[model samples]
Target: MKGISENMYCSDCGKKVKDGADICFNCGKEIPRGINKYITAENLPEEYKPISMWGYFGYQILFAIPIIGWIILIVYAIGGAPNINVRNFARSYFCFYIIAATLLLIVYLS
Candidate 1:
């Protein structure tokens, strides 16, 4: 994210092009600047960055830890986590737990 603008991207390599640059540093392609259609970062609403695969894997591992993991999972699911991706994943995990518990309870009762 550093040295990259949220709005500008290299058309050839798909890397974010430097702001006001005439060429794409990533692909050495000539860039067409001053395009009127592109919206700057400031014009766009604040968005949560996408969670990387490693980040999701780490979160899942953290959530797998017993009672402490449960606490963290609950916290994240309840919007304690800043990233929407993390929060949504946590909520989905929480739902999985709920559904699992319900199934277990039904089986036990039967």
Candidate 2:
């Protein structure tokens, strides 16, 4: 299953967990959320100071690699990008993804 499928059942309450859920609404069990779960779009930093400008675009270009590549991408997405202090969540997320992808590619290719 590429993602939480419709057939999937909640591990906690045995009820079905909806796709992209942070918690099982039916049982209140904490489900593993994605990278975006840590912060909302509105709460992210404002500029791309620490987040490399080349990062996001780079990840998109490398996303096709198997297991390791995807794993690295997730890590990047989770680490977030550096901020100028305004808390630019989206920019941080993009930068993290980019930087992680670049590093992963470098490591894997060598």
Candidate 3:
């Protein structure tokens, strides 16, 4: 009967979790050794720090503009962006734009 635990405990909330579970059902927090590797602030590299909230908002505002926004989007989407996160965001943004345009066109034609 040794090493035959029926359940596990959440380290943060001390709530009981099912054995072999990757998240705490009660707290909804990812358990250690879960599907996604948890990265803490201390573990983050100096160069990989996330952009400030204001900076992200500014990017959003800039992206909402017309001609300049398109130019910036193209630059970011086409590998000219230096930050990987920004590049990925730009690519996804373009994908969203294309999908939205297609949907609108379909609706208009119908």
Candidate 4:
């Protein structure tokens, strides 16, 4: 017969938890006695993954393009993109452009 360690069980709901998880996703509770460690990942979740340095540089270059880059930036900023990080970046960049353009217009008018 096999025996299960108490650490293997969830503290809140007493359910079996996945090994090395920081929290019991199965029962939505913290692991007992902090036995669970943060699991290192070889590949992070796609949407959660950060944009690479080159990717940012590429995006900057893309946004410099006459028409297509602007379209892509606007679409992503308005939630057209599936990835939240990309959307956030797009929104931030769009805001920067808007601010710059507004400042330019103010300066021109003044």
Best by lDDT: 1
lDDT of 2 by residue, 17-98 (tens): 6555566789888766452233444434354334455754565555446666556555545554244421344345457768
Give the candidate number with the greatest TM-score: 4
Residue-level lDDT of model 3, residues 1-110, one tens digit each, is 53544456788898987655667889888776642234457544444667778867777777778999979988988988767767777888889889999999999999
Q: How close is candidate 2 to the true structure, as a TM-score?
A: 0.29
- Displacement of residue 72 (Cα, Å) in model 3 is 0.7
What are the per-residue Cα lDDT tens digits for candidate 4 across 14-80? 8877776756777788665446543446324467677888987888888768789999999988998
Tally clashes: model 4: 0
Taking all chains together, each candidate's TM-score versus the true structure is 0.58, 0.29, 0.54, 0.61
Better of 1 and 3 by lDDT: 1
Between candidates 2 and 3, which one is better according to TM-score?
Answer: 3
Worst window of 10 by summed lDDT in candidate 2: 81-90
- Candidate 2 regions with alpha-carbon error over 4 angstroms: 1-6, 34-110
Which is the winner by lDDT between candidate 2 and candidate 3? 3
Colliding residue pairs in candidate 2: 44-87, 44-88, 44-89, 45-87, 45-88, 45-89, 46-88, 55-98, 81-92
Quote the lDDT for 31 in model 3: 71
Residue 9 error, candidate 1, Å? 20
Q: Judge candidate 4 against the unseen true structure and give its global Cα lDDT, from 0 to 1.
A: 0.76
For candidate 2, the per-residue lDDT at 107 reads 100
Query: lDDT per model, in order?
Result: 0.79, 0.55, 0.74, 0.76
